[model samples]
Target: MADTLVADLIVERLERWGVDRVFGYSGDGVNALMGALRRAADRIEFVQARHEENAAFMAVGHAKYTGRVGVVTSTQGPGAVHLLNGLYDAKLDGVPVVAIVGQQNTSVLGSAYMQEIDLLGLVKDVAAQFAQQVSTAEQLPMVLDRAFRAALATGSPAVVIVPHDVQQQPAPEPAQEHGVVTTAPEWRRSQVLPFDADLQAAADVLDAGERVALLVGQGARHARDEVIAVAERLGAGIATSLLGKPFVDESLPFVVGTMGHLGTTASAHLLGHCDTLLIVGSNDPWTEFYPPPGAARAVQIDLDGRNVGNRYPIEVGLVGDAAATLAALLPRLRERTDRGWRDDVERHVRDWHALVEIRALTPADPVNPERVVWELNRRLPADAQVAVDVGSCVYWYARQLQLPAGVPAHLSGTLASMGCSVPYGIAAKLHRPDRPLVALTGDGAMQMTGLAELVTVARMWPRWSDPRFVVCVLHNGDLAEVSWEQREMEGDPRFADSQDLPAFPYAAYADLLGLRGIRVDDPERLGAAWDAALTADRPVVLEVLTDPAVPLLPPFPAGAAKLEQMRTGLQQEGAAGRHAAELLETYAAQEGAGR
Candidate 1:
């Protein structure tokens, strides 16, 4: 038998790093690694994916659910190129994923071989770290260590490219071990300059003021108690950003609601009217809450000092963890002299909830996107994991779906990439097969990136117990809702009507995978179909046909400006424009139909 190659050693190192599964597709250049994986099949399982994008997405889902580094591999050239989308998603979400890509043989460096491409240069901007393997036996361990450490340290994706020939080379007599430890930078508890005085000053401001409001962000993930404590101390109303929604239970007394474009009307009212706005750990970049020219005065607290004054001019900028800062400021906070303001804010939130009920729940001829989300929220178990894609679905879920306190909900790129739902759903199912996993995806998004994963899920079902991956596809067959709104503002009333597309039978696609598939056209059958899928002890897909006419008003209005700019750039009808225009029309139609 030939001596164990460097690829075997690399696999051993991956095992030591606690990686049990690696998601990717196999190809010629990566044959050595595949051979090693086959030899060590008992130690680590290689999850062969239909697409490299799904592999990266699966890694993201795994990292989100397990809080551990996710691993993926791909072949040279086109394979590695396709992984970039998912890698970007991992970077934007602060998820740790290690990606290994196969490269041409070492001798072919700069020779323009068939599969030769600058993999490192391709991913340098997005990857936290990148490495190239020189001689497999001598350099594999060092490169792997560097990649793993960089991924864990920054909570981002790391890429490593291995040459085909080098991977098959035998190790030297004494293999060198690279020892690198990954650790997070210590977050010191420090009070900002004059923060104590500022707290007292803020308290005084609140003492005189009648209404107070609190806004929380992702930085407040673990500071739920501190937020509630501060809200209780000041008798103030509490609201959260879309990312911060899971921090506090919706049932809390002071929980006003979410803030932004898609935010509750009551929460927006409280933010607009409050004399003193306490922003805890939010960048507050969304313009729907803080529009230009006129907004309320605010006190912002964030660990990163740079984010403090970037949005709104701050009355007080406190630098520290939200939990610690809020805890320290709690003692200095005083109850508002007039309790009527608090009462008014609470009433506004209630009224806003009622308004949402009317818009989302009123029976319409076609299914309401809001009704589907509300029903899913009601039927899902408290601990069920939800991975939501971008576009109208995100808007609907962010505003309507109330996640149970502490349950995990994964969103795609903070950059807001489409087609992340299926991969995210697959990863969630892989990580927590026992827990019910749900994906809320729009037809456009599902078709864009995740359609291939349906086959991957079917193939992997035998390995998992009760692979209850439920996907509720909101099919609108058009993307005109947002586009129509934008056109209306541009003096083109007919633009919305021009963007419409034929609907694909998504149920047929699901059925092809031999999975339970249900199509729902009416609002009434949506609940029953969703419930049936969730209860089914297998992978199920529920295709709910929603109206494409409903416009998706995003939670943050600031994002709309960026989309409008994109729409303008792609207004022409060339290959790129036609594709872009088609997507936009489909998205708008979905939104309009839902409305």
Candidate 2:
């Protein structure tokens, strides 16, 4: 038998590590690695993405949804550079991801040869724990092992740069076979129970407060029941950071929606009035949205001690798993009566729902964008995985998509990148092939990077019988959020000239790719379109022509400068001006009533 190639060892190690699929685009530098992947197809699958960025995002989504280390490979220079945006998303979210980058021959180390770049230097800051270039084939196994170790231990991206020449070298043997090497990698999970003193201190902080509010992040996703139990015992109202949406049961009486710029008014109100804010597994970076600095004494619980009080001032910081910490803290605390706090929170939640319903159900000349999300959410499977892009579409989704507990959703969050949803949907479906997956994106966002990904979706799952994935395109003709931002932040008149985009016939585009397409222009037909897409036998694109004039009102109160800027912009505009004025008045009334 021919000696095993170094490339074979790379693929073998990945298989041994339990990586089932690799998302990436093929290129010259990775030619050897790609060939080895094909030979090892039974052991691991290679998911070809349209762009390296999408590959990176798919890996991020896979990691985020599966709690596994997502892996992606890219070619030299540009391909590796394109992976940054998606890698940064993983970085901010603190998820485990491994990026395998193919580099030019080592012979041109500093010659600036075609596609030759310093891959390690490029990813060091973002990859966090591991970013190394492999020079010798003999060193490959140990370096690859270290890469996986760093990713699994830190829950951060690890990058291994393998040059083309290095991959073609002869592989060394004597390494034990996969089954024989039975020892699992060593990685420390957060302490289940905190030290007795730390637990007591956390309990005392909670006991001293008359009113407490609970906020959760993605860290608490696996501990939903524990979070709810603690909230109920403390008579605390619960809110989620956008990423923490899956943690709270939307059906709960005291549960408010997400908290931040893309949050609910009820959540804003809940935070403002609380005497103690107990944050669990969240570092909600928005300082402005946080309740006034001194208004509430705060306590934070997180597995990583570094995240404690990272976003806000805290009186007590308990480092441990959310479930375990809360479990230990619960026994030491005194149960409090509701004292009308829950009732107040409930009323705000109800009012916010009323507002959303009114907007969602209202008919418009061009369909209201909110109606599309509402219909999609209603038609979606209870356990569907959702990926929402950042923009005007997010406003509709954040407020309208009442995600059921246990349903997973991916958002760009801190990075706030557009064109992420479709790629996210692709990876989500690949991870949970049997479950329904949906991608929600705006016209601008879809056009940016998602439209090209439709081809990949169509080709990825040709054998699946049911429509495994749905892409909902809210096709308004402008970068609606950017236009709104110009009006709201810069006092610019609503100008469609710069923001307007050609309305691509997305449904037709889908049909051409051997996928089902449904276009809904009328709000009355929106539900039917959603139903058709949901049941289609293949991937479906449901394009809804949305009204661009509708204002996406901020859930929280705006400062005087922003309010004045919006008013000035409205006055300078025409029909949109009148619409903006009405939206402002309606929101002002709702805010006053809720308070």
Candidate 3:
């Protein structure tokens, strides 16, 4: 067998695309590709995940953490099908990822062959920007390059499908022929700024209002200084979408914190009272938390025009790079001299900080989940990376865990996929082994896929430089988020059969893998447990026995209605819900007292 088959050429092209690693699992469909990867191991690395789905999640995480186009591969049929969940995660969160999937021989495709699948059709939705199949060796170069370019241009996942027979073909060296096509793997981002007229229009709106509020999202990540400058100029209070949390320093006096269902009371107050809104790089879907339709005159700035007025009606839409747009608008904006709005915003933030402390200290059955996250606020290292999964754990992560400046905390933001924390943490750690990573996940999510991904951690931790990977499992035997959603949204009691999770010894499983295990049942021990796990010699599973009854309450104005719904649902639970009702009331009382 020649060493330079089409498979070999494919690996070479990936190297040219600047992909250092590819996450995947093997099957018969991709046997040729695997052999080529093995032969070219020095240049491109291969990471084997526990499952194909997890491999896809790793790819998404890689893009989010590394700020590069992530690459993933899998066989056709079942393997190709499993990549959908993670591909959706990448698409929904605007992360760039490229999936190279193997297909059955072209001859067998229409014959209904054993492993045949309509590969192009399968990835159409998730890889909406680009998806193509390589029919000839000569087609490989163009297909691969376009996938990379399209992914970067659109900030979404792309796909390249190669047939099993196509993989065995000799690497094509196309000469100057009529039908031949070739391309280069290169992508560059432009410093796109808004038109001068639009920038002036945006400034006019901001100059008119005294009580201005700025809402930011992940798109503002690179423009932190500019965002703060704009907020300061307008005497504006800042509130973030959860995806934008890590980009801004949470300790800022006029920063009201994240605004949404699991957001801060200060954020709710800021949005509720503001007369003018300036949205920067965020299309957060929580419309209820925004200033009511006619309450505020809004100006939105985003590079992607599609999100200009996506969640809110705005008087001005400035489509441009956030930093450049903000800088241009700054010259036209007159600085606020009243300082009254700034002082009120700072006071609200100060009150919020104290209220959170009281909420974290509230009594629970064994341990308050908020306390587990609150303790990490001060202990998080300057360089630590955080990966959080969806569920009640996200509520704590969103509201309690105050990220240190420059620390990145990523989750399955828009897709809200559970079981992402383990895979995301692994990908971040694998990319930068020198830095420590902490994953916050609920027990329901832990049981879904985290338990299996631990084996991947056990297999790889010995190769790491820091060797510190902490997986904090909120061992509350319930699907708390959905349960609360049912109560809050539908005014229904918790259906124990659907919400309860089977007990699993997360700590013991870590011990089985020869990693450290620490279980915390007492609230007083949360800080010590966090300290122990952060400083451990190897991977540690910090399984926290958290309370499921702690209410998932939104900030006020919107939260008041949800609070009534929750009480109504609890009233119907009879004896089964008395303890939960009491806990809910206690939490509600604490919020009032703290405020």
Candidate 4:
């Protein structure tokens, strides 16, 4: 029997770091590593994704849903390259993920051997916090420890590159005598909070203003009660970035919906009217939606100092954990006696909800995409986790779907990458197979990556405790988001060759995969379809043929400019633009009435 290889040590280190699974694909460059994983199968399960990119996405999803450092592995060259998209998602969203990449043998350093591309250079940007190439077996433990530590501390992607020869080398034991470093796999969260003076300053900002607005991002996930407490004390209305939507309970009467181009009119009203703005744990890039620079005095609280005062100019910045900072600041905050601002917030929220219902009930060519997700609001399971992809479906999800309180939902936020829904759904499911998952995606995204990831779902569903994985596809036969963007953003007519999607029977394909499939075109059948999917014995794909002409309406105030732009663009399209124009007019009218 040969001595245990360095690859074995790597797996052992990961186990010590509390990693339960690794998502990846294999190739010759990682043959030894794969063998070690097989040997350590009892310790750490290896999840084989259909592609390298999906594997990386799974890692990011794991990090997001579990609040642990997600790990991914890939072979040399092309496989290493394929991990970029997923890694970028982690970096941009501030999720922690560690990538273990295989490299060509060190002996072929300058020879340009097969799969010889430089791995360190490729990952440096995405994995800026930490990226190292291990040349010796003794370096593995330290490198792995630092990678995990950096990933967790910085909340970003980290990469470790091991050459084929290095992976095959004998595992090294602890060296006690000299400069060689040894490490243990451990990380803990610090109770981080800002100085007392800063907290008072932040509280002062909230107390002095009669009209205050609160913006929550994913960072405020654990501080739900604290956020509500602050809002109540300040008599402030709450708005959320799309990423923060799952963290806060949208069912709260004064809580307006998401903020952005796809956000709710109520949120636009709250932000526009408030004199003071409090941003918690969110670095949302929707600057245009924020109260025009000088309009609102801002106070931002973030664990990271780098993110403080990043999105909006602020009167004060508190670099601290959301819950801790809010709790400490609570004593300093004065309760507002006035109820007028609170009344305004409640009114806007109620009107917005009524408006969305009206939009959902409006007739379409086949089915309204808004209605598809709107239906989920009433039927979504309390324990269900949601994963959304980028497209028009994102607009619907942002505007309509009301997640049950405490149900965690995630997506490719800052990256806005398509085809992440299925992969993210898989990660969330595998982490807690007892909980059901819901994935919302557009037909264009299914074509991009969802179709192949569905295979991954099929392969894994048999072992899940609760096999209700519902993948709802908005099969609109067009890249509706981009099509609308062309008209709304650039004033250009729809380009058929570029915008149209080739028809695919998504539900039929799901059935072919031996999973239950439900196709609902009629608006009335949507409820039944969801019921069947949630109760099915196996995973289900619910495909709805939606209309492409239903416009992607921007939120109020911003929509004022976009509405005219949309009208001009549709008019330029001649006969083809008529349906879209009618829909846009209806949507615009609804926005005006709601606001």
Candidate 5:
């Protein structure tokens, strides 16, 4: 009989925890682990990502889409270090992930061996819940148990560092005694209802104010029905943080879009007019975007007690799951009348939508990026999952993309990492092969990480029967976000030498790799290009030559200082100054008039 190796035991335990696949790159340091994976090929699949960073991101994206613990592996040193960014993305977003990295052989413990670094030291801060290196075969099962448990409990990244030699040793034999490793039941928790007193206090706060508004985030995604019920009971207008876009139906009369710099004008109006704010399952960092400190009395509910009132000062803080809390609290609340605030906000939303349509339909020489995103939004399938990159694309998505209530999107929420969209889309496609997958990235972001992962998509495309994947590149030939930021913040002309990127033929590059490539340089060809990419026979790359001069400003108002700063910068710009200045002034003036 073959002795169970330490690597084999690790794979066995992962399968027990319901992990069927892992994303990683093979290396000499993890040779034994790779060999064990090969042996368990039928039960578990190994996805080869080009860069170790992309491997980690794929794991994060898989976790996001499936709501499971994402897993990724890498070799020692640089491979281990490369996992930090994606791990931190998981950490900051409060998603569960487990990272397994190989280490130098046990024999080279004290010596500064080649490709040997302190793996734990590099990852401890980011992998918040658990980070440890296994020293012996006996420690393997128990440590893996603890790591998985901690990730499940806290929704944070966990790390396990196994030395090369340690992975090749014999596994600890199964014992009759039960523990976390062998006989621990699934880590499922019973529903916890909020206390009567806390519920009453929250009800009292809601009852006192006539104009109540709701602020939601990703935590409220599963509790949408309960949230809408509470809103109906209180006549509350709903607004979301960027991550909470899936929490409510955007088409609802009083349901304002996201609330932040990327938020809608309607959301701003709703948040400002409310005398009471009900924050559910979100820790919104932008304090100014919410009601003023003394203006609104606040009540908050969250699954984690520590997050209660963390983002805003609250009169009543109820610590329970969003659905449970809302369900309990709704019974005690009195139904309120519209009081005309809802109508006002709804009108604002309608006007905002009209403005957005006008801007989207307005034709330019090169394709308008806003129009491209708006077109995609209209054409996207209901079940599709989109992974949007950072930079100027954030403005278009946050402003123009009307995400349906049930459709899920993967954005670099808090971290706002640039190159996540392509890899995230690949992961989404791998998880849900039937659904349409789209990766929206700026040219710079695509150049950074999206281009490298094309080969990965090409490799995996043949395996799935219906692999509908599209990588939409907004090739604006510059980092438009940074350029706008430089002008708005520093009152300086965009430093062309630093911010400008050469015009790269991304569509041709895709064609060279034997994928369907569609390029749209004119607005007339834009509609067909999107249709072609969406219904292509193989994975497609749709590259659009968008205008670089478009301002990436949000619908929300900029303060006086920001407006003046942007004006000064625009004045310094050569011939393109007046149009940009007028856009800023027009929005700023409208904001003042509304207030």
Candidate 6:
């Protein structure tokens, strides 16, 4: 019988799990695995990344857009260390990623050999599951299978540590014959929780109450119609979490806009006046919305039984699929005495819309990030898939951008790491070649993660039939503008004056990567530049020199406090403090202006 190496078994397992490519860097510890990949190059391609962090970020983007398991590999020590940041981002963002890291030989596991580190302990916090492969020949398939399951089932990143000695060992006959196993969780239909009784109870509360509101989250994505149905039925105003924004049209009469720090005044007013609030598929903390104390009775519904009342006191908590629960309750819900509630909510929504037009998009001194998102919403293709990295850009895009039905957006990170934009862009293009993919990143974050993947995109463009990606960098050259405001609320006067970075020539970096680069300092040119990039048949970079003075439209006051703390720390301390203070001032001046 031919000698089948453990490395071959690992590759075979990955193939069975339907992984066609792995984004990673090569190292001495994983040389045998690299060799195995070379032999099977025809079936699975190994994408050599400049850094392991970029590889992990790319995997996240791929998984988010395509609904496939993102795969990444790294060597021991530093290589594995670099992966932690990106993996944490994936874990937080709920992206399913499978990472394979090489370790020193099993014999020297305890000894401090060259490049040897306790990889399992290092990644325990960031990874959902961590396992060390002891025997390349015996435990290869078992570990790989478990790693894949953990990542896919929980929508989190998992790490499998492959020791050098085991990877080089010959696999047993049983290992070679082992096939991949996948377990699909049975999704039972949402159970009816005494629908008539719940509906009657809810209707009684609404009828007796003068003001009412509806709150939605990601759980409401599929039940858009039902959400609208229930809102109309109850004559309730609607407010959504960051994840729930795209689920309903903002133009709808009931939409009071998003609720949080970035929340509109009208939404806050409506929430403040509500006598009862019905929550669907949302786990957003109440402290964020800051509902007026003792203002309303809360009814919550969610998929997971535990999440229903985990954060806030609830008068009623229903555990089931949001859409199913709403569908069952809608028939029994009675038309209430609140005749003009919908009209009132609609009027508030219209007034807020006018305010947004006047304040958010006024051709002002410094361009608003909100207006940029609005413009992108107007100009980009209806089905364009957008991947947003963390920071100010997240608040802007989450609150302002409007996605068409069926279009998807990716966010969430275990650690809220920066520099995810470029890698995500690459992954989006790889998974969905036909759709236009855009990466919205802040300047600081872009500089950290962008350049590394430009080369990768350049190399893959040919294979994808001239598939393209547009990278929009909001080049403000600062960090944490929104954090400054939160500090002020907490009584720290000095918290709002720190966090900034020296502006770098970002367009030049794009040019260096052989991508079509366009730089725009004036907001007027943003539309044209973005249009040109979208129309181009290749990868393009559009760098917008945003006002350094623009503050991020933070989602909550707490986030604003963090920004303040970051700023204060930057100003009173060393070089880092000064840099932070500068960034905060830039953001403070631009607060409410969008960008």
Tell me, by lDDT, which candidate is best. Answer: 4
Steric overlap count per candidate:
28, 0, 0, 0, 0, 35
Per-candidate TM equals 0.83, 0.95, 0.99, 0.99, 0.96, 0.83
Error of 3 at 427 (Å): 0.7
* Candidate 6 or 5, higher lDDT: 5
Give all candidates' CA lDDT scores: 0.73, 0.84, 0.92, 0.93, 0.84, 0.72
- TM-score for model 4? 0.99
Per-residue CA lDDT of candidate 5, range 182-219, in tens?
Answer: 54425675576788998999999999987889999888
| Candidate 4, run of 10 with poorest lDDT | 172-181
Pairs of residues clashing in candidate 3: none
Candidate 1 residue-wise lDDT, 1-595, digit = tens: 2488878877888987889888899998789999999999998988877788878888887887787889999999999998998899888766689998888898988999897888878887988455555554566776787788778766689988888998888854453356432322222235433367877766666555556778887768768899988888788888887767767777665686667765665666677677777788776456547533235566778876767877776676777778878888888877555678788877766665665565576544377778889887778788788888887787777777778887888777375777788888777777777777888888877777767778887887767776788888888776644554554345233243545545688787878888888999888777788878988866888898886545444422233453564455456324534544554455443333332
Q: What is the lDDT of residue 68 in candidate 3?
A: 93
Q: Model 6: per-residue lDDT, tens digit, 1-595?
A: 1476888878888898889989899998888899989989999989877789888888887887677889999899999999887788777656578899898888988888899888878987888455545554666776777778778766678888888888888875552344533332222233445456765675566556567788888768779999988888788889987667767777676787777765665676677668888888887654646465467888788876757776567777777778888888787666665567777777767766665554456443356666677678778687677777778787677566667767777754335677777787777777677788888888777767676677787777767754668888887755644444444444343333455666777677767777688888777777888788889877788787665444443432344445655555445555634543564555444433321
- RMSD in Å for all candidates: 6.2, 2.9, 1.1, 1.0, 2.1, 5.2
Evaluate model 5: give its lDDT. 0.84
For residues 323-404, what per-residue lDDT tens digits would candidate 3 score against the true structure?
9999999989998899999898898898889989888988887899999999988798889999999998888888898898
Residue 73's lDDT within candidate 3 is: 95
Worst-scoring 10-residue span by lDDT in model 1: 180-189
Error of 6 at 123 (Å): 2.5
- Model 3 compared with the native: what TM-score? 0.99
lDDT of 5 at 404: 77
Q: What residue runs in model 2 are displaced by over 4 Å at the alpha carbon?
A: 174-192, 495-497, 559-561, 574-576, 590-595
Of 4 and 6, the candidate ahead on TM-score is 4
Alpha-carbon runs more than 4 Å astray in model 4: none
